[model samples]
Target: MKNVFSGDFTQGFPFQGNMTGNDPSGFPFQGDFSKSETQVKPQPEIFETNDFVYVKLPMPNKDNKNLKLQHTNHQLILINYPKENEQSKYMLPSPVKRKGTRARFLDDYLEIQFIRLDESNISEIDISY
Candidate 1:
């Protein structure tokens, strides 16, 4: 089954539950994750109720309070800039209205919430007419 993210990829590339080691020939990929430079961003679990849109961003070891949330042109922009590195950006899979965009920091993660000012509906914005 696909995840909330949609698409077959949501099922993820099937893991053996505790299997390590890849193709010795390295046909597809190489390098061990145990010694990798950067890591793939973990997908956060987003829960939507009748009143608000909850987006949980998983980022650790940084001051989450510094993170910012804003909406421009109806797109939810999450800017997380670390003091020692460049700023990171994540896009909400679904469009978010700017009506009431706010965020909270807890447990090293940033929880952004958007108020459903215009009902929990997806409106397609088409400027080409």
Candidate 2:
């Protein structure tokens, strides 16, 4: 007779009790996760100051040329090279000007700043009854 479970260990156990959950072809990798083609979205850190709202996102060794950033008064969308896309929206602590927002990528982090608008300058329009 021949050993039924001795053909290939990488192909998973020949029995029905396979618990590795890997492909029957043995994990499809020798043993390295960095080589995976899947893209993971990066998280961001937000902060507020007296005059500005800031957002910082970490992305290591990524070139700035491939970075794309877009925003509205309350929402932001970001995308980095090779299919990494992330988006977020927040109720700002206060109102921002929304016209002079600025951003830059430095030290493996993307930092964005939006200038706050003075509420006192906003005029209230009285409506007629």
Candidate 3:
């Protein structure tokens, strides 16, 4: 007999549940866990070059004229895009020059570009104890 106190007892044991094969929730257990299908905001792809950082958002079967964009140094939003997924924030890999930022909608994607600035000229400060 394999018991907790017995030296011959193996650590591994078969999982046991209700004899009727129902889950602890008192419902017949089905392997499926997903309950509902809900629409979610789509994510954009971002990339960078020596002179610019670009973001590309997808909009399949949607009109380009309906797309609107707003952005700051660290955040961006596409107004009324699919209505549900209009806002998203991203962390930039490097600093960009915001003054000449540009955006365009083409085919099924909205693309935005931020000019990259030269960081080599930035100076470092020293702190003393």
Candidate 4:
């Protein structure tokens, strides 16, 4: 007589046939079964003073040679940083001018400064009924 549950079907199951203590399918028996690849993104700090809006980003293991930075009136974009073919964007706290933008990388951080746009120039439109 032979055992019914002692065949090839139970080879990969826990505490079963062969008892070799290894999964032949290359899968772990317990803990952290996630098989997906995950990427970590850097977070940037943005603030504004009376004259300038500043954005400071943590950029570890990076240099100016491969870093690309761009911006518009309300957003800042970083490219080729943290990893190749990857990009990140940061929103500015206040609107900034197109000109007089400056950036520097120091102490494993990227600091950008932009001139704040004049809010007084905003004009109110009257609603016509």
Best to worst by lDDT, what's the order?
Answer: 4, 3, 2, 1
Taking the tens digit of each residue's C-alpha lDDT, what string does model 1 give over 42-107?
567677676677778766766446556566533455555443344545554445566667776688
Full-model lDDT, candidate 1 = 0.59
lDDT of 4 by residue, 1-129 (tens): 127765666564555443222454454354443334345577788888999998888877654477788898988888886678888888888899999999887788888899999878678899999
Worst lDDT run of 10 residues, candidate 4, spans 16-25
| Runs off by more than 4 Å, candidate 1 | 1-27, 31-35, 62-66, 81-87, 117-129
Winner by TM-score between candidate 4 and candidate 1: 4
Please report, in order, the local distance difference test score of every candidate based on alpha carbons. Answer: 0.59, 0.65, 0.68, 0.76
Better of 1 and 3 by TM-score: 3
TM-score of 3: 0.58
TM-score of each: 0.51, 0.51, 0.58, 0.66
Question: Taking the tens digit of each residue's C-alpha lDDT, what string does model 2 give over 34-115?
Answer: 4255445455787789889888878676654656776666666665532445444445556677699988778887778988
Off by over 4 Å in 2: 1-40, 80-93, 121-129
